[model samples]
Target: MNINIKKYLIITLLIFLIVNCTGNDSTYSVEVTNPLDSERIDEFVIINFDQLKITQAQQVNNLTVKNGETFIPSQLTDTDNDGTIDGVAVVLNFKPSESILLEINLNSPEKSKDDFIKRTYAEIAIKKSAEFKDGKYIGGNYENINNVKVPYNHIDHDNLFKYEGPGWESDKVGYRFYLDWRNAVDIFGKKTTDMVLQNVGVQALDQISEASYHSMSDWGADILKVGNSLGIGSVGMLDKGKVIMVSKTDSITCTVAENGIIKSDIRTRYYGWEVGNKKYNIQTDFSITAGSRLTFTEIQIDNEADNILTGIVKHENANLIKQESSIENDWSYLATFGEQTLFNDNLGMVIFYKNSELLEITEDEYSYIIVLKARNQKASYYFGAAWEKEKNGITGEKDFVSYLNETIQKLNNPIKLSYK
Candidate 1:
């Protein structure tokens, strides 16, 4: 045989072997399903690529799930601020029990975006400037409020430090706390695409004390009146029916984790409180997924006290209602609804608790509070607000209670995921 012909035959045989191997290769399979029918789902699902030894960016980038939907490997980071990227977090919409196929092509190009998943996010910001002063109206010199009372009373138009307090927001609602010893939490009703926290924080306060302070539109306004009450899920201790509040949060830290073009999740840590003889700590994690009417608040407090209390601020026009717990679900909610919005529209505030963990429900002249027996030196709960002005917002008391019930159901029956 001629040398050149033998060489060509060897090359052709190698090509044929490679094609056969590629054709027989098995595609990976992963099953992702939502418990609800056609509802958007946002939860942290752990993807253990470690077992498969797929740690590098290129390997993760080539991963796809159902319908050629690619993953966001470029924006991957240590979601928990840990040293390594432990797992993949996803936000997607799926029909009930929708099975998805996961495949990988190490040689394929990386995917730069994951936009098919509709995700709404939450934000938190704290901007502190000593240049604004510490007094109630000290910052008025720097930023002119023009003598207009900010729509939200907790905001001090004069003291920019008061404006420096921590501000949190979701697509459905927004909230801030007075860091200047008042320890009061206030609410901001939202309307537009709420992706900006720093802007919303300054704008909400600025608009209230500006020329249009009195003007109210559907887009948003400082809606909830906090006063000396707990506001929306603010924490205090109920010592023999007397509400005892900490003077202030001794140390505060905030974080914005998992921020993407379409989604965000934020956390605020208000720690080091000296209440009575015991020192306490509070951590709040808020998640606002797309199309959600309420922000999911996971509150954990550290203290030796047997019980911890959280509540809704009482208002003259706001009617307080308690939903009885069912034996099957073992969860109940205390809610308020009525024309309590700063704009005089319907607003709702709710706090959900487990029946087995609840010690009692009590209210004084200030708030409608729930007392939960602290287990393992901590208690967990969810609280949020809804405004009638927002699209598809809670329209009435019934709707508000219904939302709470549905949320409880979701918490009880979370979306289950498994691997094949």
Candidate 2:
């Protein structure tokens, strides 16, 4: 019958060329290594694409990033809030002590989400100004200006509740927390990315309660001189050796959980009392990564107190360099250098202390401390600043202690991630 129908059409074309040349992949493989020999790491490999189904809007072209070179997955949708989409962060740069093997070919067809909406870089703002004051009650108003309220004075001499003060940014930096009562922790020294922390906190609160507008230097001022010290990373309590200072936080809370293409987390919560008498509560999560100048602060503390203190706001004309890290997942830095910052220029402040629970780096007469041990009460720190006037930032203190020992070796050699 025609030679058995030509052998059944050559056995159905050899089973469709062995199922299209064996690429039946639902692929997944992620193994990156940079054990650090000469030091060169710039990582972030996050991948969660809905727990790795690889983005199914038609398989998003199989999401490939083999050999290395992928970024643009940080539009931050649902970030573990469960609803979905907090996948793919990939920024890999490793070398010096390199060990790389990145492949997420999935079954590639080729497509991309290219830098995903530019990742935003980071931002947040909470402004007010209808002009209320020690009378309290100044709810949250944005965009427009009602002279705002809820600013107890620096850390709160008293007035408690009505949380949500304001301040946030990240093209490199910006911060605020003086919403009254000496809660002190202020900074806002930018050059550009200019949103300028709520117009420099309404011109330093109209130059402090209408002294009639002026200072705050055009746009980027308050270069870091947190008097009464412990200004940069704020929070103290080591007792016996003295460092109490904890008030104005009977309650406070702010948010912007995440708003970026690469980074911005601004979460805050600080509830009443801490200074041996206990009953404390502080939760700060602030992250500002996109090329970092440093602002990672994790700090949990529910007051089990094993260790907790932070610093770097002392200035007898700056110059307080202490560094420890003999390896063992490295970390310990407490820097300060020249001109005592704050408009005087040259400012550089640091306080890393990651791991080993960091037990000491103390000093008194207003700041240089870093005694952190709290593991269950949680603790993590990093606060950095460098301003020769921004552009290229850290230009001294040996490049700000080699960018704080390359961020303590990328937080003790992290970026070894693995996935199937």
Candidate 3:
């Protein structure tokens, strides 16, 4: 074979081998169907690729349901599998509907108890100090420590001393008297007595007398009360607006309104005022079952007052004729009335119309009457009037008189006329 022809033949053979290997490594498809309805089989079902050891799988091209319709995968398959293709599920159950709330049982753990005691002691100590000072220790000035306003007196000094010791001591003291002079003999007493005195001097000294301390043991009960107020280690059911801490477990059911306001059976305890609106009724050993039901009420307006005419102005025939000619000449007429009318939070309803076609009005005359009737009897004290003009400057005195009478009559009792 020629050299060039041999090279071409070798390249063709390599291409053929590559194509054959690629075909052999191609992926295959597996049809998946819901057992409940084999006819409604889906093309793709998700599976962990790593766990299933599937490097590749045939792409899902279409999905179909028997007697239903065959749809393109992009067209028919709900992306989220929620009934709607827009990812909104209209009828599919996809996630859990209920939720669980976990509450910590503070009394069950020993560590919680110890933490509670420590927290309680610290809190009470601070509170006691506050109560001791009232409003005197609010600022940096300590002159009002005991409300005496002494200069340079420290407010926290008493508290510090309570923990430490008193500052000064009394100088008064008494000594024991010896009765027998021979027994009380000094330096010449005995060598044994001297040894006893030396031994006593070496013993531990009584430091209690040296320290001027005040014992808090007398206020132990008060301190404990303060601790209990802090809700240290107690466990209780949150009921109503309070926390109910009980000794035994009891089943309690409460209904919560839709407004999220709780009206439970628990009562307020000590320090309730300090807790403010965040108070929880601690019920001990009690479990709540059901909450309160929410109720909503809507209000509707029933009867409304109707507008009554306080006064009216009638146009004379001569004046009507003059006004008609003036209106035709591009002039307008005005009506005036003055009276104080009570509106009382009501909207004013007004309607204007004319008897002649030459007289133009902006709104539908019948609709305005209907609105005025709906007003019931709400009176408007303000004065109002209607304007009239011809389409082409045609002055008709008779027509003008008729229009004026009609408009005035309409103003007096526009609401009485019914459109329906």
Candidate 4:
């Protein structure tokens, strides 16, 4: 009886060992490759023993591509040959709410064009609504960002010219129709500026965002208002007139017609400069000469601060005194054209412009007198009278000046052109 029992026990022990070895010998292999890398396939390989089963019932939290490395199921294996588990192989079994097949056509004649189109399409798909909600992809402001609908405001008109002669005459004229700030901020949020700055850098970002956010519909309404006032696009006699559309950036210029035709929109200047800060004092000898039929349609002032002068003073010409006065004081002259002011409380002229026809001259002789100035002010202060007090920094006068210059420049340039 004892021998028979030992034999049976030995057989059972052998069978258990065999089963354990078989289970340990089970192997699974997975190939890892970089989707972004165009050169090579099968970038790496990983193998797993003992065929670990992943819980398909659970949902995935998030997935992301990090640092040119990708994670695969087989890669999640114990490197140290110990009985303890080191990593896990995840198999997500939950049915996707929706599956989208992103088909890309790269049949472009040019390789560069084909690659660009393919990459852009891939980016759009990765950010698509379905993939975002499923948690298959991560990063980007997906949840917070959406197609927002808000009132649109665009550039009514932007006119720029090098003034010359005694009166204002056009040496060169450039205009831009752009999106308004209030409307743009309403639709795209204030972060739109940061978004654009990321793409185009600090210089062109604001202009591009302001221009692109506003559509042609906004442009049409604004143009109609201006045209109706001038009786150009009305139903009567002036319907068939020509409409001229123009836009000018610091570096380039563009123009188009009302019939969706592109006209003389070319890059005249290769380089451009932008105002750096709010308050500045730039002395440039610039001038504008206008003809007798010149009419000032609009005048926009960017800086509403009490003391800041945005005007023109000819070299050695002192008659133009664009002064500011305060109602609080005894009507004291706050700032003079050629002089500077210490604080923003002193009243000053911010901006001034008038629309006038060009004066016909024997020769194309003109000059411009440019003057830019700003004031320094206490932005914030504590009311306590004792020595121990608190103070905070406010928007600098130079910073205000910079914003004003940028805004005024946009107003002077329109993005679209039309024919009456």
TM-score of 1: 0.71
lDDT of 1: 0.59
Over 354-393, each residue of candidate 4 has an lDDT whose tens digit, in order, gives 1111111110011121111222210110000000000111
Top model number, TM-score: 1
lDDT of 1 by residue, 1-420 (tens): 999999999999999998777534424445655565545354434445553355555344333333357553222334343335544545455556565544434333444345443335434333233233343432232332211111232234434432445455555666666544566667777776544344443433433555231245445766776777888877677775678764555565556655544334455566676666677786655555445545545556776767777888988898887888777776678888899977788888888788888888888888888888777766667777888876567788888877777777766665665555
Measured on C-alpha atoms, candidate 3 has an lDDT of 0.19
**Candidate 1 stretches greater than 4 Å from native:** 1-29, 34-87, 94-109, 113-164, 194-198, 201-218, 261-263
Give the RMSD in angstroms, all C-alphas superposed, for model 2. 19.5
TM-score of each: 0.71, 0.30, 0.15, 0.14
lDDT, candidate 4, at 255: 14
Among all candidates shown, the one with the greatest lDDT:
2
The parts of candidate 2 lying over 4 Å away from their true place are: 1-33, 36-90, 93-124, 129-134, 137-140, 144-163, 167-181, 184-240, 244-260, 264-287, 290-329, 332-410, 414-420
Give lDDT tens digits, candidate 3, residues 1-420.
999999999999999998676444332222222222112111122222222232324232222211113211111212221122221000111112211111111112212212211100000011122323442322121111111111133332333112211110001100010111100100101111011111111111122322121112111100111111111112222223233223221122111111001111111111111122333222111000111010011111112312111111121111212223232232222221111111111111112212221222111211111111113211111112111111121134344345444434323321211111
lDDT by residue for model 2 over 20-86, one digit each (tens)?
6544545566677777766553355566766555555634423546564643343333343322444
Model 4 weakest 10-residue run by lDDT = 381-390
